[model samples]
Target: MSSFQNLKKSRDARRGKPRPNTSSTSGTSGPGVTNAGDGTYGMDDELASKAREVLSTALGIPLGQDEPGLEFLDDPEVEITNVSSYDSHGRKQNVSPGIDNLRSKDQVTGKGKGKVKQPQVSNEHVRKRGKDEVSHELYKSELEGSGIEVHTLPGKGRGLITKRLIKAGTIILKTPPSISALQNQHFQRVCHGCYLTMKERNIASCKNEKERYEKKMRGELKIKLNRCSGCKVLHYCSRECQLSDWPTHKHECIALQRFRKMYYKTYPTKKQDDDDLSWTQASPEPVRALARIIWKRRVEREKNGGKDGIWWKQIASLESHVSKSTQQEVMRLAQQAQHLQHYLSASIPLKGSDVDVGEDQLLPVNMEDFGFEDVQEVMNFCSSFHVNSFTLSSPSLTPIGVSNSPLMALSNHSCDPNAIVVFPNGAKYMELIAIKDIQSDEEILTSYIDLSCPYDIRQRDLKERYRFQCDCKLCEKSKNQGVDWVDPRWCVRHEGCKGGDGKGKMPVKGSKGVVSVKCDKCQEDFKVNAEEVLSVVQKGVDVLDSDEHRQLDYKTAQKALSTLIPNLQKHLPNHSYPLLSLLRLSSVSHTPPQSPKDLQIASKHIKQAYEACYEVYHQNHATPTLILCEYAKLLSLQDSEQTKMVDLSRNIAMKNTIIRNLLEAIEMLTKAVKQSEITFGKGFVVGKELEGILEGCKEEMERLKRS
Candidate 1:
């Protein structure tokens, strides 16, 4: 998941690795600087989270200039981001940094250069696309029930599939982002926060003739009406859209209106609150971590004399433009706080169960009021109790106060999700896409990320990181074995073993299901069918260390690995542990290791492992990438006599492309990793293999180009 990759990137940043280019993203700046491990791109995962935090502040929330996270002139993700802080595009009134080649070195563009050319990359593609905002149509249509589907799903709750296949950039849903209306203001166009008029919400063209005509007169942008007495932040295009939206919102709007200024209230009646706790584990970790980041951002802003507010995103302004020195001061403080969060996440002692929330901690109030009057309450809220105010209205855009609600909180986390939620700009609107064809009544699952780690490692991280014992079917069945396996764990088990269908639906104890049949490991009266057992897979993972495997024979294990891995792969997800074992076996295919056939086999296995690993995991998954590097070394063999070839020229020609592609994959993974680092503090960085490969490739590219 991109979110996890973001977490990984944040961790990497903390580890002192350079951050990725923030300019490539929309408006926000990332917060966490953790690293991640994955299979695809080499550099992306380690820095995505910090990148997200940057963007969040950039576009999502209504923030004060003095808030902590802002005030830096340089994009945090870039190593050579020497330009006065911020992406070069929005420098006020000054001649922008026009250097294009800077982006080739992973630097944000300085704004005015023609382009940068080197061995690996020549230039960077910046976002000419506007920030993530609602198109007039999506906003208008959503209220009128445009593309929403509320159909009944089988095992999963109601499946919310798209009415049509939407384009990547198209706005799927939009509601008002966080609104900041003064107590006395009646009606005025301003930024929802600082009140930037240009940052409009969901203003799009009307497609239907009737809707178009109505909007032109008084539908969308031209509607004239009574100014909102409370937060006058809302402007309806027509009475129709307002009227259309009112049905879904009058219940909450009226409640908000009564409070006047910013307010947070608990459900007066217990009946009003429904018990939705799916994310008690995963949700709290990320949310609490984010809240802390928001505070650091706030504090940093204050030190630099820049009032800053936190939002959920990938990039943001890091310093004061007028006083560059002050920007450094702000960044220093925010960076310190960020580091502390990272360390604490890594070092803290964890308990086994969920932390209960006290009643006093559930209420919503102005952050200032909460901090000043009820410090303990604030602490409790930070620890484990509060509303989800940061949830996205659409997968991409967030509507303040609306995002944190419980209705959107019921979904659970999975390493390999059954559903995909895409919020393009990472602030407001979103579309939950079903990646594969789902069954009529299957539980709609969306993987939080690829479940490529060994079973133990996976469970440990989920429990400590996300805070939940994943009870998903896949996790449950895989629990007994060290990995998530279908019924036929061994390609073909020993003679007497008969795997039964893992699901309980099998009437006969011995009966098993196709995908997950159990082995014939029979007990006194009961036969543990691999098929039936397979249906009950475990979602959480358990971490495994060297001590546990010390007893295995390396030589014999190698032989077994070769035999079991490929067949095992046929029965499970691509990035499974068994497949990795095969790669290890293949890695040492030769005696002296100088033979051609040996290198060929090693390269083939390594490449195969990476391909499978990447297919099943995050793009920047480290294990496979590491294997790929080992493979690359073999592929780049040179005896000095006759460069006995194996697509040597092709590999050389496509050298940059391969590493560039790897870097691209890593960047995506970095986004997800950054999120994990912020919330879980797992010290994942760009996979070791990614780092090794890219550096090696860069050198190789330069060598090839020079020659």
Candidate 2:
């Protein structure tokens, strides 16, 4: 037989559609009817009964004798050959019991039309089938010379532990993402290949009207992105980047183009403006990541002769949390699966072979090749992505996309983590660096969420997103001792307290609608309505978060800060989280200070904000380092000329102060460089930038001394 004929025969056998009963009368010739005279009538009836029983068992729904949907089982077009069965170990297995349909003719046949002999299974391969063994081998291979090993912990399933002492600033592991994609919002601003944001490439639009005008006045060229010609959604920084990403982006490009066409066709009245691609942004990052994964698996399966490659196996090993998913999570995943199905259907080949896609426009993947029995498989993929994905970040630690690296997910979460994941080079590569010196046999842990948030907020976010309550040392310490040192949300100052020079903290606790407080030193009790304090603080936060306040001018920003800061201070602590937020806002809102007074005020606010940040986020953290860099820059801006004092004594004092400020700025910049090295990684862009600022500060100090 010809290859095409063989292919058709294989496809037919896989579908398992029964031949029609031609001998039966026309009235009884429909599906589920077998001619009484036919010798196979009883066998056909038994097969139908078994299929119905398996379907009911798999679906967990009883199929009564008079079930209305019974006719579809006998329909020739409906394929019902494969059914799920449990093995002796109670694990679900797919039982096909025939030649695999995906096999090529060469793979299926040997010389003289004989079947190809299968290879013997080895004990190693059998051992790899166990989850724990697979994880151990995968980590062993991935971290061969990195001095780390995967060990099963008592409570934690599997953790990366140090085989040798790992010093701080050491690169523990570096792995490229198996799959990564930009969020829909970053599609235009970030490169699809290198994941470099437009701003990082110095091609982004001006930040504000003033900056745009300044650039225009200077006759600077306005840079634009090179968008993918097929999709018009993904942007590239250069032709080289576009070409480099073609292997992965080609499938996505075709899918996006089809999605665009389908979208406009579905909503005829909805018009897309020239610069607006919001219609194309309907699918989120996870959907795009899942598409990439499916396409990759298809390509790999073909290359590996009908077997999934190592990449797919690595991703599949990660926990999906499907069995533990709540009803709401299941519903959400179901909706996402529906969206994925719609997207895949739009990009797949049509029913007939007569309509073939051109060489320039290939379909993303053949849906039949995916082997997804139902939408449940897609939901499982989505769940795995939600649980195992990481925030793809720039070298400066700004989030740009979502990525999945199975090797990196081995480390568990801890509030006081010893190791940290960073993309010090770029989003294409990730590095796990030790933030603290980890001794041998110490389990490597990394924070899955931001640590700067208060204790309650941190716990709530972790529970809602990751479905676990953190029992890290920091959490336990907060629970056993007091949260005041870690969370300052409820700490207030008592004016008339008899401890610490009449200045002591009044710990506030609230329940229901009332708040009670007692001074630590004075033992005085006070009561305040929760609504009166919390409501006001929440309103202030909302105002700061609003767009109107976000773009205020220096004068308007100062006025807003003046009004909000004092009110919040009256009801909250001097260094409360809300007050820290307001202080940081004050520093940024009045950038490029208009006058000496404005400069002084901005400097003061930033200094206060830095102090608060230092207390909240310890010295070696990224937050404090970032704030210290800004504070150093502000200090460098304060000079003798900016202080315009008339009196000679005051002028001399101001000059001395300027000298002191410059010296202090130099010292802070030097410290910031070191901190940046630890947090952002040695030789990272942020560390280099801090070093440059420190050098400039040293130059300024030398000029001051020479004068």
Candidate 3:
């Protein structure tokens, strides 16, 4: 078949519609329903049933059911080892000369100074617990390298290193969260069990309940939540998820119930709602986490007669940075502790009343009984959480919730980090994968913030938050260049300009608040202010950030992008923003381009965007892979012969160009698929989707050869 016919056939097949056979469709027999036999030709019940049965057998989907919803399951790839077993095996840290010994004498000596009271049971005591008292334990496999060791740097506390060589995209740790909580904004929207949000299903803005119901019935949505029958507050995507969360949530539910009663009594018939109680919810992220920690410690102590569990030891052992905290921070933490104490104390039923809650009910415990009066300990836990909690985000790193993963937290930071951390399975689990190769004995590092930011801002953030001066290679390089670290604004110099109106001077850098600069290379002066340029770029950024941008029509989006790009270019000449905006406007499959020329423009921007993103982000990052996939798709649209039929010689050249485009598409898709598989696990939704696209690209290549 001709390329155009092939494209048409492929499109029709994807839509589950057949091509019109002119001979068979001589008369109108209704859309896709041939009048082959009885009036029910399209409604052949027996045939339909058979098809459903086959699909059910093949996909393991129920005969009459929609696709299965998102599942947060233990990663099958990771091996679970009991912590007791690993420690007993005598396979602890391989202490090299430079590496600090795991059993350093200084560890015990240093323990007495923290604000949080050290657990009565030490790490050694917890490890010596009888096997019968311990449950099955899993360790995140950062020990893949026999050469891997934990060493305490002379000045800089504990850091990890590989004894042997490791490559980029290597799996360092695949671990679940030790403690997780949704950010206040997402508390109501996302499921506590699976972290599935209506936003993921594109139903967050459904017009009404009826629209949501209609969509669910049509098999386009599956996020029906089962509200917790007990508290009537928490919701889960399924009964299984609800059951999975019951143990921890039961206590919180009871506490919430009592808190609600106390709230009503305090307000006393005043009109109050979630808005009034918003503060209560917003402040509880860290509070709820602290409650969990306290509950675990209590349960462990009760289980082992006032002895802590192995997990509890790990949490208590985490660096609380108590000594590092200033008096102001300590005071603030004290106030926060008081606030939480007030909230918890109110949960106690007022004196004298037959409030008979039976064994079936969960009861709140008194804070004093649990030794919560050590408010300094609360401050210590909060400090640890502040310094160490990882933002559980989407695949693209959009912050959704906050979590603390013990194993994952051990990896340190570098301005030029060699590893990337991603939440592959769900927001509950964190996967730390290396993004660059390192020789044996080199440290593994990840970035705490966007590494694309200028050096000065990064340094300030690191100092204020992490309390460290980064001496990473990138920071050193920027430092050596000049004292001003880096210029936040993009250079206004044209790309091809040699400098100084044919002179040899070049524009060096543009700083914020500066008005203009002459080229250091070419001596050509420019009339541009850094603040003005930043203002223009920020306007485009605002549009992109706005909710309306997601719903804009293709034409309107294209027009807006056209206006945005020039403004962006005036500031950030190689900024990924304009290029990304163009790629999005051009590559939407639901909204096809107005013409092939639009696809051509999209392809051009794809190349530019891919380059820009590569410069700014790691090669295996999600953004670069996404750009490659879009570029490949845009090239696929140009497979028709219509472009080659312009004229004779021009036509031949066009064919050659099309052939080159196809080859390039194949190369890009292949690389993107590989990178996606590494960045996101092979079985992740994004990875599987990219694999499907790669397969399609391969088939397209085969078709091209035949043509």
* Top candidate, metric lDDT: 2
lDDT of 2 by residue, 42-106 (tens): 11222222321110001111212111111111111111111101111111110000000000000
Candidate 1 lDDT by residue in tens digits, 1-707: 33323434444444343322111101110001111111011123333243222110011212221121111121111111111111121110000011100011111111001111101100121112211132222223333554443322222222233434443223333333221111112123222222112112222233233343456577344322322222233333334434533322232233223221112132222232112221111112223333434444444565656644332111121111112224433343343233323322321112233112211111222445112234333332222111111212111111111122111112223444433332222223323334334333233333321244444544453332222344444555555543233332122233233434221111223444443333333321233345533332221010011101112333443454455545444344334443443454444433125565655555566556556555444332222333343444444342311322334465664555544544443443344334322211222121222233334435554554564
Lowest lDDT 10-residue stretch of candidate 2: 23-32
Worst 10 residues of 3 by lDDT: 23-32
* TM per candidate: 0.30, 0.68, 0.60
Q: Please write out the lDDT profile of model 3 over residues 1-707, one tens digit for every residue.
A: 22112212322332242211100100000000111111010212232223211100011122222222333322122111110000111111101000111111100111112222111222243233422111112222434434455544433444455556777667666667666655444555556776655433233324433555577689876455455543445656666666666556665555555544434444456675633444234234555655655655665677888776566655655566566767755554554454444334323333223233211122233465654456577667656654555544444333344456555555555545666555554555667666677666666565553343445644553444445666667767755754322232223443444742221111333546655454435555545566676566556544432211122454555666666766666445443332343334333421234566666666665566666656555676444554565565555566555544554344666666766776776777677667766655465534443445556657756754566
Stronger candidate by TM-score (1 vs 3): 3
Which runs in model 3 stand beyond 4 Å of their true positions? 1-147, 187-189, 197-224, 258-284, 326-328, 342-368, 371-373, 482-490, 495-531, 534-565, 576-609, 622-670, 693-707
Instruction: Provide the global lDDT of candidate 1 against the true structure.
Output: 0.28
Ranking by TM-score: 2, 3, 1
The lowest-lDDT stretch of 10 consecutive residues in candidate 1 is: 92-101
